[model samples]
Target: MSQDLQYWKQLKEKNDASAIKYFYDQYIKLLYKYGYHFCQDATLVEDCVQDLFLRLWEKRSSLGDTDNVKLYLMVSLKRSIYEKLKKNSKTTVTEEVPEDTFDVTFTMEEQIISSETDQITKDKLLECLETLSGRQKEVIYLRFYNGFTPEEVSEIMQISNQSVRNVQASALKKMRNNMDDPLLILVVGKLIESFFHEI
Candidate 1:
């Protein structure tokens, strides 16, 4: 197994309050960022993160050997968000409905340097994300932004597992088509890794 998988397995085996605290401290920001992307409300995002950690701690003993704990967190967050949305019918925006405009705090220049991607590539990818259908964007966010598995995403989105795979594949294809710079793509990948690790 990869080093990350090994670490996660160890964490799972321990399943103590300290272990849960460690997980929360490490991943809370990433989870909040993901939740904010979906809900665009800081309070809601914070609540989701809190609820997810609470749920994880409560069910830690029953948790299986997940190759990726980050993925599990993402799945949990997505499910929580879906439930939140479902509970309020007026908040249920169709996949195609345009989300309200919100500030993207990461400036292009900052992202280029911090993410190690060229300004052009960074801009292109951001633009590409905007171009994607709402469902496609959600899948991309869940997959890369929060690291959920397709099965997890399928459950959250109430879609078939195959549909989740298809959306992810489509999103990747679109991103690849838009971003022709290999170096830039590698840098972006590294940035994503850094974001998760540093959080």
Candidate 2:
């Protein structure tokens, strides 16, 4: 196992407060940002995150080792968001979770774009991003931005590995329509292209 993964596993097994706090500190922002994609309420995200950590701490000793700490936490956060939303949704009959509710913003400050012309391109990219389903965007964020492998993404997304590949294929097909837009490629990075090629 990787040293870093082993370190976290040891920390969790020992119930180290610093390690627990470090996990919370390191991931809170990403978790909050990602959770907001599902539910717009900031306080709800904050509460769920806090509750997630609390439950983790409460069950730390019993938890199994994880090679990818971030992905494990991310999967937990996604579940927390969905469960909270479902409970608060208060439907008498089961209702489908809205598939298009995710929102992700790519800002110019990220330095992938630098010119006024690129600003227009950034706008176009965001417009194109909206063409994707929420799960598509989630997979893109996980696979491209965060560098998770397809198997890892399958675990975090709670889908079969085949399903992850299928979602990636579909998302890329939509993105292929904009392959001529160099600015879009630059902004999201050639990671998209590389990911597609590898798949």
Highest lDDT model number: 2
List all candidate RMSDs to the true structure: 7.4, 3.7
Q: Model 2, stretches more than 4 Å misplaced? A: 1-4, 92-96, 107-123, 178-191
Which pairs, if any, clash in model 2? none
TM-score of each: 0.58, 0.79
For candidate 1, write residues 59-136 as lDDT tens digits.
Answer: 766767776677667768866776676565565455432333222333344423355555676676677667677788
Whole-model lDDT per candidate: 0.64, 0.75
**How much is the lDDT of residue 90 in candidate 1?**
61
Please list the residue runs of candidate 1 whose C-alpha ends up more than 4 Å from where it truly belongs after superposition.
1-15, 90-125, 142-165, 168-199
Per-residue lDDT of candidate 2, residues 1-199 (tens digit) = 2644765776767768777777877788888888887788988998988998898888878887777888888889888887778788875437856656666764433433346544566676666666888888888777766778889889987889898889988887786576576656675445346555556
Which candidate wins on TM-score? Answer: 2
List, in order, the clash count of every candidate structure: 0, 0
